[model samples]
Target: RGSLDLNLETLSGNLIAQNHSFHVLEKISFELPRVELCPEVLKRAKSFVLADPIFGKPGPIDVLIGNSLFPQLLTNERHSLGANMPSALGTIFGYVIAGTAPCLSTAPRASNLAISLLSTTDTDLHSSLQRFWVQEELPVYDKKSEGELACDKLFETSHTRDSQGRYVVRLPFVDNLAYAKLGTSRPIAAHRFESVERRIHARNSSPLKALYIDFMDEYEALGHMKKPPHLNLSAPHYFLPHHGVVKEHSSTTKLRVVFDASSKTSSGLSLNDVLLTGPKLQNNICDILLHFRLKNLVFSCDIRQMYRQIKIHPDDQRFQLILWRGQPSLPLSTYQLTTVTYGMNCSPYLAIKTLQQLAQDEGSNFPQAAHILKHHSYVDDLIAGASTEAEALELQQQLIELLRLGGFELRKWVSNCPKLLQQLPASHQEPPVFLQPSSDPMFSILGIHWSPVTDCFKYNLNFTSDAPTKRKVLSLIARIYDPCGFLS
Candidate 1:
């Protein structure tokens, strides 16, 4: 008999041993042709098996609503309450009393007659009523009438049940719901526009991939969240150190990209083999320092969703974890990210690494050009900087390609420059067109506008410039200040 005819499940132990003794394991290894698996095909296969009508159509939700393992068919379709009583009212009473479900303030107001009926069954009903009902001027319930007012009172309070019967409290459902819908609608519509814009501006956002290796303890220690709630809500609080170990150091013309390790979490990198390798450190420093030089230019652009353009290696995805609808979804590494969400430790390094790689390819084609690209993550802000119009353009081109490589698509990037040049007198010498961006809020760099109303830039300025010399001096300023009266 062929070995294939043997039923392993039904085979006796002696028969199995005899077969194993006679059988020789075939020393065979076949290579699978490396074919790219299409996601759509796999999806179709899984869906066909899982959702096939041959497996039987999905029954009504109520069919399996409350089935338990031991008493699987415990169906109590008919209620013990009188059939004349409304089913909804009978259910409400049964749930509140027998199931120990709490009653809402609306419960009492709606079932005034029911409560009185319950009082006859249980002598301590008055005490239960007093405990749940506060001594307020509540609207009277008429046993004879069922009006809109009665229905309104019934649903007025959001209620819950505890061991002690039920409790009811006024909820902020109206405001919360309105805000939720607004938030949901706005993002959906904006994202639709963004999708279209991203396709149009795909070239600008491509060649970047980022990783966020958040030194969590350090950021917390630095008090990135130290500010009071009021200030935190108004604006993001940077995890920058100011006092003690983190005092601002002297400025470097070459662009100092220092990872302040003097702080407590300074040694945190050692935990995850995230050593600042010589080349990686050098690249990081280069990205940071060059950003300073780029800050002085009038027409500066930001690569939209730059970090998300970087992909994290699939093998390294175990670290990235975030909750979604009570389930873990987002990974800690930018490598697997599909959206540009904030807060990741490795995002900066990953993004900069991707950009550096892109720059290498772009720069290889233009060896003699002076181009610089800088990236940094003060938490989630992936700042980029480049010198010269050509360099900036190159950087933008490389970024677009890099982002596409990393699997993210982006839209048009708007550069912010002062619009004052448009109003300049014909005789007034206009500065080179390359050095200007619009001053209007709609035209500022990094997708932020200058808030003329607030006399400040809409987003936090990571770098600034001021010069004592007659010529335009280019350097990062000591601290970001109010943009109002900037010339003075």
Candidate 2:
């Protein structure tokens, strides 16, 4: 059966010879339920038979045997019987029906040889009789009627977000042997570690950008003021509330509101009202520039929920928000912010002022701290830069105090500036040293592991291994067959 010919001509001859034997029985036992035969399949097969009454008759011998005997009944009600039917029966049945019992009596060829041997019981007859059989009869390979191929489906479990705020599709597993050709199998299974590493390494020319930050477009037509205010805030000056949009020098580049500003009335200089003026920005930027130029490194850290730690100004607590039909609404005084919101204009400035005050106080104990960080700077967006590791550490210690005083907690999985990392000779690049905790959970920006003790950062290296990376494996399967590729 392994090498048995499956051609239309060969199958036709066998049917003619078997036709006589088929009529010998009045009603053959099918061993299968009659309902298992699908009307649609039968109708399709019926097209191949001759219109002649004698040729059209499906007699006892014509009854298909084996598992496929009931394939037509692959419906839900009769599936049990059909599912167990032997596969070979379906193949043979399909062949007979497709060949339509060709009239070999007029022109007999290898088909005649096949027909002549159908009734014989000789074991070697198959090989000898097959010598006249045409070996290259084209097969239709019509799987359309066979139904969709059974392949394991990979589903996206969560709404994964990309940098653009679009839901990203994820394929956690690599296409393994299960997806290979019927008999083709591979020795190793794919994982994401290596592929992810290679993708990271390929972008070595530039520093990685923060995943949480993005360039915002401010130039799009501003929404009509008539709709409804999404946020409620109390303000003396027109402080853009957090999450609000503001225009920069250019219409194309709009700066999103990260903080809010307010004036303190009848107050002696409290840190809250010290508007982060142009002088302050210049001072902070200057320190940042100095460290970056000298040390060839600069990094910023964010306090986890920095504003949430600050008590709302007693006079300003009235402004809060209410969610109505999924939209924020209501009076300004009632909307209490649950956490530090990033779009407020004053939050960043206030946060910076607080940090500076805290650093000044902490530096008093260790006078060298202020000197070491003489050029280290920040403006709510905490940047630490230094020519030497010792300088960075001194700054880090001061920043830690600043964080503590401001009541903002530091995340352990945070990252520091790689440019601040101590340069190593080729001889010592493989130790697990730490410089600071990562600010991002995914570590998309750092591109390497940072250790504080050894003060070292190492490039990730899973790209070359057998394991596939999240990004690279995604890219490979993407090239082969991206789901969106079809749609596009």
Q: Which ranges of candidate 2 are over 4 A from the true structure?
A: 1-287, 296-300, 320-334, 338-345, 366-375, 385-395, 410-488
lDDT of 2 by residue, 1-488 (tens): 11233222122232322222221223445321212333434444443322111222232233433343245422222111123221112232232322222222333232221112123343233433333132222223444221111111221132133342212221111233211111101100011222222332345612221110232111111110111234322232122222324453321223343333221122211123232221122133433433433443334444544444544332233222211111113222212333323543344434444444444545676554444333344433344555565666666666555456445544322224443333323222222333336532222112233333233433433345667666555443333321112213
Q: What is the C-alpha lDDT of each candidate?
A: 0.28, 0.32
Q: Give all TM-scores, in the order shown.
A: 0.25, 0.28
lDDT tens per residue, model 1, 15-48: 2112221111222122111122233322322322
Relative to the unseen true structure, what is the C-alpha lDDT of residue 272 in candidate 2, on a scale of 0 to 100? Answer: 30
Against the correct fold, how does model 1 do in TM-score? 0.25
**Count of clashing residue pairs in every prediction:** 44, 45
Instruction: Note each model's CA RMSD in angstroms.
Output: 30.7, 29.2
